[model samples]
Target: MQKTFSEKILAKYSGKSHVVPGEIVEVIPDIAMSHDNTAAISKTFAKIGVDKLYNPDIHLVVLDHCVPPANEAFAQNHKDIREFVKKHGIKKFYDINNGICHQVMAENGHCLPGTIMTGSDSHSTTYGAFGAFGTGVTRSETAVIMATGKIWFRVPETMRINITGEFQDGVYVKDLALGIIGKIRADGALYMAVEFTGPAAGKFTVSERMTLCNLAVEMGAKVGYVPPDEVIFNYLEGRAAAEYEPVYSDEGCNYDAVVDMNLSELEPVVACPHTVDNVKPVTEVAGETIEQVFVGTCNNSRLDDLAILAHVLKGRHIDSSTRLVVIPASSKVMIDAMRLGYIETIVSAGGTLATPGCGPCMGNHLGVPATGEKTISTANRNFKGRMGNRESEVFLASPHTCAVSAVTGKISDPREIPVDMALIFSELRKATLSPVLMTR
Candidate 1:
């Protein structure tokens, strides 16, 4: 029987001739990842009475959230994690300077194609960008994986999303992601795998593809995949840590639902104050004043994102009433942006650069908005208190929209800003060619 990508991958990992949706199978993960919360997971592992890991090689620990220790409690969490890593002799460990766990995993050659990875964080689905069958599990599940190197998964039905046409100027992948979420609502694809396909999906660069997969969890998807092709192969050329065989769905494979989207019909859109699915075209909410503009997060904080923000803000200053905060998703992204002068341009334009990590995206510290203040951010979610203060509001948009809104101190359409798309693309290409991105 023909099978969807998820079915095929799950079958391969589970040692089955074929698997169907809702069937549970046991499998060993290529990597089991956890971040700062590993402290909690470590405690659970200790309770299980496992003094050693089943396989230290398959475990990857990263310290990102609340890095540099926002306070004593956070500091203690990091301290406990370090002790756990050393005690278990886990070689695949990254400290506070590495960046977000997902980006660090990709840049370090861990998120390979045709593999299975589980993380303690929901956005583990980001690994699907490389054709990996990635998903998130609870802290208890992760602890169990650490002890036995095994986990069980119930195969999910697949949802297929097809795209056509090119993105219009001032519009981006973030807008497309928001538009899809708005149409489907938050629980539309609960516990299902989402496959993004078609001409437009094929055209996105690997980093852009990452953005598409990163937001999959926001729509309640168990995972999201962009079919592996030359773009993926080229990215893994020097970066893949292990050999991988790419996988694809069979023709006429079954899908629970198929959604068709036309890129040409999309415009600059934002997820308004309270929720990710509460989206509206920028024009519908123009002139809503903002106190802060954030241009970084795991979903949008990459070199390409910085190039767009820098290009738009070049030689222009942000509104005096609005504060701009920028954070690169990883140390590598931060270095590339600095080498390309994107950092200088943003700082000169009145944006403050924080340490390269989650920063204010999680509202843990760094750049949280004051009570009753409003912020336009590039983060994937805008739930109440998402940015730390329950009274502060967050409006989610693309980096282009956030940059433009910073200049106007209001929710504004990016098309109103005159920019040379060609120049921005050229700079981004230059950044991609850097040696830092080409190798581990």
Candidate 2:
């Protein structure tokens, strides 16, 4: 049967030859991930009366959200998670030193093409960049997956997003993602599976591809995917586990909707104030003063991302009025940036490099903005109070824009400055370092 990339993978995991949209199937996911919220998931697991995990090895837990624990309550939560891991012999566990759950999975080898993985975090869709079918589930739902290794899903209809044209200098994948989300609106693809294709998609590296799928949830998608190809294959060759089959969409497969985007016309767009869909070209809002500029998050904090910032900030410092904060997505990414000297470049340019974790992006830890202040960040969300005080504003944009704006203390257009494409590409190439090996 003809099927989209997601449908094909779902069918394979459900033990079927074919599956249709809206069909409910029981799928045994290749991996189930949880983070600091694992404490809550553990509670649900107990309430469900499950004494042992269906397969402890398939379960991954990472402590990140409030790393080091903000206070006593959070400290106890981490303690509960550690106890759970110890008692259950969960071998895939990662402590605070690891970083964001999504990045940990990708940097390691847990998320691979042709496999379906679900996490309790919304950005679980980030794994789709590696050609895996990734979706977010509730903590309770995660508990069930831990207990049974199986979860039911309604095969979502597919949305084909085809792009043709090359990005102009100074524009990055983060800009493209924000543009797509803005055009599609917040709920545009509700419960649908989005598949990226076309010349533009082909131009993206595995890291850039992650930005596309990472924001799929912003469009209300159940999951997002990119078909496996040589680019992704090369990325996974040494990093991904060797046991899974690769999956892709058939040529004649059906799609519920098709959106064609011309990349050449895309600009440095930002999601303003209170919504991911409230986007406008930076040109439309330039000169809007900002108090802080953040350049890392699960959606944009890979090694490549930090390298881009370093390249942009080389021999330059941010505006004295703006506080620049940088958080590496994971310790693996952080170590790589340091080895490449990108960390030094960033710090020398006045960017504060925080530990590997989701710092300040969720307003739960460091770098939270003050009331009435404004921040420009690479994070996926821009809702009120998302990054600190409710009165403060958050604007989402590409790392290039975020860095350049940090220099100006305002919403700035990245295109206003000449970009050294050669330098950026060199950094991007160096960014694909091998994942750090962790002992089981």
Candidate 3:
């Protein structure tokens, strides 16, 4: 029987000849990840009454949220997570100094194609960039996996999205993602897996693909997949830990729906305050005043993203009225940005750099705006109160758009800024292609 990529992977892991959507199966995960939330997961693990982990190697604990601890309680949470890691002899632990868990996982060779991995964070779907069957689960489900190294899934039907054509100057992968989510509606793919295919999808770099898959959850997708090919293989070279069986959807596999998109028709887009699907082309919101601009997050903090922004701000300074805060997704990304002088370029342009973690992105502490203020961010999600004060608003856009807005002190279209495409592409090409820093 022909099977979709999700079905094929689940069937292989579950030892079944065939599995269909709506069917539940017990399968072992290649990796089970948690972060500062591990404290909560540990409570569930304790409730499960398990003294030892099913497989210490497969369990990963990262410290990202509330990094450097916001308060005594947050500090205690990390303390408890450390104790849990030590108690179970878990070797895949990453402390606060490591940066975001999703970024760390990908950079450290834990995410590979054709593997099943789940985490307690919604953005765990970030692994799908490498063609992994990745998804997020509740703490209870994660605890069950902690005790047994196994979890259950109701195999989802697949929705195929085929994209073609080249992205015009000033537009990027983030715009494409927001465009798709807006068109599909917030819950269009509820409980389904989305497969991205076609020329445009293939043209994207691994980091660009990560930006797309990371936002899949916002579309109500259970998971999003980009089939592993030369791009993935190239990124994983000397990085992937174990031999992987490459998998793809069969030619005749069933799909619940198939959507075709032409990248050439797209314009830089953004999601207005209070919703991820309330998207509009940049021209629609041009000149909207903004008090701040943010240019980093798990979704858009990659080297290519920083390089693009740096190219735009080479000799210009950001608007004095609009504050700009830049955070690298991981320490390694931070180091790369510095080595390439992108860090200096941005800083010299009046951008403030935050530590390498999820700061301000979740409204935790850094760069919080005043009530009623507005911000344009490269991070996914723009729900009210997501970036502090409920009255303050966030407009989500591509890094290119954010850079231009930071310079203008208002939401602005990148098309208004003159850019040398040849120089921008050259700088982008200099970014490391390896998904994981093989040597660092």
Candidate 4:
């Protein structure tokens, strides 16, 4: 019988000839990732009475959520994780300077095509950009994986989103993601694998594709995937650490649902203050004042994102009342942005640069908004109290929208701001072609 990508991959890893949705199968993931929360997982691992990891080579530990330690408690958590890594001799460890765990994994060659990876963070689905079967598990589940190197998965039904048409100016991949979430609501694809296909899928660069998968968890998807192609192969050329065989769904494969999205019909949109699914076109909420503008997160912090921010704020200053903060997704992305002068342009335009990590995305540290204040951010979620302060508000949008809002000090539409797409794309090309980004 024809099978979906999820069914085929799970079957291969589980050593089965064929498997279907809802079947539980045991398999060992190619990579298991954990971030700041690893400290807690380590404790649970120790409780399991396993003095050593089942396979150190399969584990990746990254300290990113509260880099440099937000306080005494957070510092202790980092310290515990470091000790755990050193004790276990985990070779794939990255310290706080590395950046977000998901970005670090992708850049360091851990997110290969046709492989299975699990992480403690929900956005672990970001690995699907490279066509990997990536998912997030509970902390206890992560601990179990660390101790045993084996995990069981119940295969999920597949949902296909076939996108068509080219993106309009100022309308971006982020808008598409938000539009989908708005239409389907938060629980739209709970415990299901969402596959992105159709002609437009090939047109998105690898970085753009990452955005598509990174937000999959926001809609309650178990995982997301985009079939690997030459674009993905080109990205993994020098970066991939292991040999991989790409996987694809069969032509006659069954799917739980099939949705079509027309890119030309989309406009710049934002997830409103309280929920990710409460999205509205930018024009509908224009003039809502903001106190802070954040342009970084695992979802939208990269060289391409920085280039867009710099392009929008070039030779212009932000609103004096608003604070603008920018953080690159990874150390490599940070270096490339610096070399391309994106950092200098942003800093000169009244933007504050923070250490490359998940700064302010979780409200753990760095640029948390004051109580009763409003922020326009590029993060995937905007639920109440998401940014540390229960009374503050966050509006989620694309980097383009965040940059424009920083200048206007309100929830403004990016299309209203004159941007030279040609110039922005030219700068991005320079950053993309840099050798620093090509390193594994």
Candidate 5:
């Protein structure tokens, strides 16, 4: 006789005050985000003749994507947008040197639990790390949210992912995410709200949680939510994020389905070339050589990640056959690492370091591999032509794995280099990682 938790949340978002998932309910969106990727979005929004953004204070304009813009012209391209944002009275623009769009908003606490939010970027779903429902919408849709605090949503069916067991050495959150993508496929979860359950997701950090939900859109998920808990509360308290009564579904709240998983023996993993869903344990794909190892991206370049690679490369040099590239997620991350001597270790070991920007990942600048060259990355996404070269082969792994691969030239696993990687791991475990970017 009673509705499930999913049914309740869906109904409220869909439109009705009563339990309804498909009602067109209006919520005063407390937060929203936009960035350079949508620089042209405004022009498109005007095509439909929308005069203003939903609510200026609730909008954040992040400039992380092409920051320190590659060329003088593109840099100017963003400059124009900066001027426009100012004209539009946008107050929360990150500009260059701030950080990634998703990273900044998530870190600063624009996201609150149990609210619906929207952004122009597909990865906007990353806000689910805090149990909020966020999704990527078209620029016009984003503009509509900008013009009106409310947007539309049809209550989506929910899917439960359950994981039990501990991850083995060298595997990190990315691998787990890729594993889920592999199981769900690119479109398997279309229009659904993905609620990660089970022990494994619970063991993840706020940063890791962001990484998991960030990729939800890749599977066509409408949103990705993790119920509130101590981790969520701890991350939000003392930060710029909104103060909300921590909300979560009761333990007895209904779920669409329960997924039980045991991840005890999970090994270092890779989401193979061409697809994020092509997952295979690193052990199964070992001996695969690579020509480059990249460390850093908005999705993976946290202090903890840098520390992990710093440990792996402490005394080891990059292999002659492999080139190592590291781009700090933002100026703060770069500056912080430099302040702590992590950057020194990374560079002294023959690792090539670049300023904070999305270079290699965009394939526009940086180490664009030659045809047939195998590359390993710590960043998210590995589609063909994604990294500047059309035929370059890419492999995705954790920072530890990326560093180890650089040391050995091939796709090396950090676990195999224990002597050189132990202290780093120990240090990483004790390091205090915080969000370096300003987010909603």
Candidate 6:
């Protein structure tokens, strides 16, 4: 039988370097991540007659969820994780202060192209941002790989999503992801690998592209990828670059599905409460007063994202009815934002800046929306009770949208904001068009 392109990439990474279905690949994981939510899984591994961890160096544990643990049970879980990391000599323990595991891992170069990765959290798929074949597993499964240096994957069919057209001002990667998800549905790409390609994706910065691929599992995808280009190499080079070849899908690779997106006429999008796939243009729900607006998290905490927000809210103050909270993804991001005057600008404009960490979004550490309140955020999930109050409603949007929401006290469309978004986009285009053309 003729081998498919995806099969070829997996084959090279497989222990034997050959194409075979249902065969467990044994490649080394470039990175592994876990959080307090899955801390119990680490205990389960110990109970299964596993005394020592597989690869202490490769294991990365985060203390995100249960930050100030909601209750005794959650607090104990974090405590257990701490003891385990200490006992195993795990050197990569990021306490609650380290921000979100996914952001920290990628920004710090823990995951890179062609590397295999696993994490206990379902969002582990976020590492696909680095062009790695990454996914989630049970804590025990993760532990076994930590020891055995291998894991299994059921070869999945591939889907190629080509995004084209120019983007409207104020729209961002988050909007594109929501647009894609709305079209594809929660299970639209079920049991498949989604490979985003073409001009639009190429226009995105590495972090923006990462934000898109990180949500692969939201549509039931097994994995998501972007072919390694200069953006990928630049982010990887001089950080964690190595002398190794990466396998790419053949030029004529077979695709189980194909989606063509033309975002030229697109507007900022929002995912309504309780479902990421329930996407609608921001205009549809704008002006509905909001109680809280959160900006930060592993999914949308890049400097570029913050810069965009700063530009949007440079002279505006939060709406009297809305409380805006900004949490950087890491200590580094916070420090840099402060050094660049973004932090001061945000604070003086009535935004409360938090330390570098994942709490507001996690619902365990930072501000929790009051019951029945409405919230807007730049975080990944907008599922029920995702950010603390079960009765509260959460809408997902880009940092630009979230920032404007803070000022308007409602879900906002960036294009409608007082900011000069059109000029912003025009200048952005001129400044970036040259480099993109050069690269091509």
Candidate 4 per-residue C-alpha lDDT over 302-330 given as tens digits, one digit per residue, 9 for 90 to 100: 88888889888888999999999998888
**Model 2: how far is 250 from its true place, Å?**
1.1
Each candidate's clash count:
0, 0, 0, 0, 23, 3
Question: On residues 107-132, what C-alpha lDDT tens digit does candidate 3 reach at each position?
Answer: 88888999999999898888898999
Identify the runs in model 4 with alpha carbons over 4 angstroms from their true place: 432-440
Which digits, one per residue and each the tens of the lDDT, describe model 2 over residues 1-440?
A: 57888788888888898888999999988888999999899999998887999999888899999887889998999999999999999988999998888888877778888888999999898888888889998898889988888898999999999988888887777888888888889999999999988877876876778888999999999887887677777666777755778888999899999999888888788899899999998899999999999988889988767777888788899999999999988887888898889899999999998878888888988798988999999999999999878989999998888888988889899876656766655555554453322111
Q: Evaluate all candidate structures by whole-model CA lDDT and list the values in order.
A: 0.89, 0.85, 0.87, 0.89, 0.73, 0.74
Scored by lDDT, the top model is 4
How much does candidate 4 score in TM-score?
0.97
Model 3 spans > 4 angstroms off = 428-440
The reply for model 5, stretches above 4 Å from the true place, is 1-10, 13-15, 19-28, 250-254, 419-440
Worst 10 residues of 1 by lDDT: 431-440
Better of 2 and 4 by TM-score: 4
C-alpha lDDT of residue 394 in model 5: 87
Full-model lDDT, candidate 5: 0.73
**Cα-based TM-score, every candidate:** 0.97, 0.96, 0.96, 0.97, 0.90, 0.89
> Which model is ahead, 4 or 6, in terms of lDDT?
4
Candidate 5, residues 1-440: lDDT per residue as tens digits?
A: 35544456555555554554444455556566777755676666667666776578877788866667778877876977787789788887787777777776766678778766678778888888888878877777666766666766666667777777876667777777777777778786887778887756776777777878887887778888777676777677787456674345556655555545456656678878988778787877777988888887766887767877777778778888888889877666676677667899999999898767676787867677888898889777888888888788888887777878888887766688753334544444444345422111
Ranking by lDDT: 4, 1, 3, 2, 6, 5
Q: Per-residue alpha-carbon lDDT of model 6 for 193-227, expressed as tens digits?
A: 78888887776666677688777888888777877
Off by over 4 Å in 1: 432-440
Model 5 residue 134 lDDT score: 80
